[model samples]
Target: MGLLSVRNRFIEKLRNFATLSDPAEAALEAATRNASKLPARRDLIREGDRPGPVFVVLDGWACRYKILPNGGRQILAYLMPGDCCDLHIGLLAEMDHGIQTITPAQVATISGGEMDSLLTDHRGFARAMYITQLVDEGTMRAWITSMGRRTSKERASHLLCELYLRARNIGLTDGIELVLPLSQIMLADSLGMTPVHLNRVLKELRLSGTIQLRRGSVAIVDPARLAQIAGFDENYLHRRLRPAIAG
Candidate 1:
């Protein structure tokens, strides 16, 4: 009773879900309905709302942010394709932040009605979605560690390297270059630094011969040296991607 035609597109994506029996086929079928696809900088969802199915980030970068008491927006996290965006909130009673696009994006919103149906009908799907949120929680812990313990320069480099690897694995990056639309201001917000400080760190990386960043292109002159300086570990992402139903 689902869209049976576009099964091929879901394989690579659902392979990371672990609970998907036939990732390529079942996941494609599950993605039957897409309401509206909009460009970035639009609000996809907001805070203080009820839980829903999930937004399967089909493409582009989005960030969850909350307005602080001081009238500043505190960016919580960045969501990529395969990320559940608000999976944690969906399981809970309320939303804490608003999810908005950062780039010209493509997002498919899974319907709440369909989710209600899944909880009643598809145990496998329900369980998978729950675990996916847990996976999300683990990543939050890692982000916190990176921000609190690591230096600002390392934090900035770490986040960039993380995005590069994620994009590369999904065929978005070729390892040499990353297409990032984020401004230094946004980078400062995400890394908990000021624009002036971020520029200094970026300059340090450039002077050290580790990275060349301009416009949308980011080239790691020394990938290993960059990783060493950033203290990045891709274990959280890669281990999550290891095929559950291996061939």
Candidate 2:
């Protein structure tokens, strides 16, 4: 399929995630016009570089993150379909983080010049993109609290719960049975714990029958129990319930 076709399909998927007014849709279509697609594992954009064109994840998942001196990585965010990977660039003094693929993905690049043009022409587009930035900031604050205050067990479960919420927003999860791609070691880095410690906590969660992870798939055996263990809360995502969509 062509870039426009991919964009149209992504737009359809996004309607389930957020209310994109018609003008917003037009603005997005403009940015996507004459775009190029990227295969998975390609560095669509990197940290510490001038903000280039925004990337639309036509399919699959990507992560935005930063690496510490010892090579530890903190995944700041995951971008799914209907989400813009560099929408926050306009607000940043410089790029301080990097993005990479987690799953096989098809991506479309929209030039910064076109984004600037759309901001002037598409009021709703500007509003939606700005809202995306605000949403990211709020989630970052939650991560700070989770990593700093929550227990290692809480930290992992919280991340799982959070991904569940995000995956739902992207119409990927059905409110449960979400898949987390990162291994236990990756989980440790994001939660600021040693891999050994993270593995220990995972064992505890599994033994308690609150959750289970096998073959890279996570099954919430007892969501309420799991929530209790990790102090998971849906409020952090700030997403509209799927059932709330209008007829």
Candidate 3:
């Protein structure tokens, strides 16, 4: 894709939090103009590496994860198109977790100097970026809740629901169909279940007419039903901006 298109995607995600001024938009466009493409299953950054330029996913999917000494991996979060891996990670001395691409991905790197200027000179952009971080934290909390309290079926359903909505928000969905690009192994790892157990849960969902899974894709046959089974509430995503209330 062209640079303009990439900038538009980032702006689209930021608009979910705050309105951007002309300069803010221009700054982002310039910062993200140069992008590099990486093949699927490539590691963008690894644990213990020194923090460098903040990486943004301009296209395809990436993930935040940590691997245990036992060779087990735990996926912490999914990074969709337009999602930045870490906007303010410059303060950290080293990466605590690794980031890897789930598909052939286009990524942009914003230097610490440019990031500082964007945050210092652009109030609207800074506010939007801060809120974006807040939403990321909220998403992590939701994932924790899913792992600790939800059953296997509920976890699968909830993840599907969340990915569908997120894809829809970023205009990646065609109606209720989403191009998930995720393998069963990746999904199983994200949901904290064995591949066999996740396959069973997906079978149950398909049998119940909640969703239909195709190669690297999913069609939500009954969105409301799927959400109901997952007991999902989109409030945690904070897609809509609410006015500040007076104290």
TM-score of each: 0.83, 0.82, 0.94
Tens-digit lDDT track for model 1 on 1-247? 0122332322355455544544424544556446245677988777887766567666667888887778777677887655555543457787777888887556676666655665455454555566567766776777798878999878888888887887776667666878777888888887788899999999999999999989866888888988998888877663555444421
- Which window of ten consecutive residues has the lowest lDDT sum in model 3? 1-10
lDDT of 3 at 151: 96
lDDT score for residue 202 of model 2: 84
lDDT digits (tens) for residues 1-247 of candidate 2? 2334444545654454456667767666655554445655666667777777677777667778787888777877777766667654656766888888766666677767777876666554555556566666878888998978988888888877777767766656775577666777667767888899988988888899887888667877788887787777676565653422221
Which runs of model 3 end up more than 4 angstroms from their true locations? 1-7, 242-247
Candidate 3: deviation at residue 199, Å?
Answer: 0.4
2 versus 3: better TM-score goes to? 3
Which is the winner by TM-score between candidate 1 and candidate 3?
Answer: 3
Q: Give the winner by TM-score.
A: 3
Please list all clashing residue pairs in model 3, or write none if there are none.
none
What are the RMSDs of all candidates, in order?
Answer: 4.3, 3.9, 2.8
Residue 103: error of model 3 in Å? Answer: 1.0
Which of the numbered candidates is closest to the native, going by highest lDDT? 3
What's the TM for model 3? 0.94
lDDT of 3 at 77: 96
Better candidate number, 1 or 2, judged by TM-score: 1
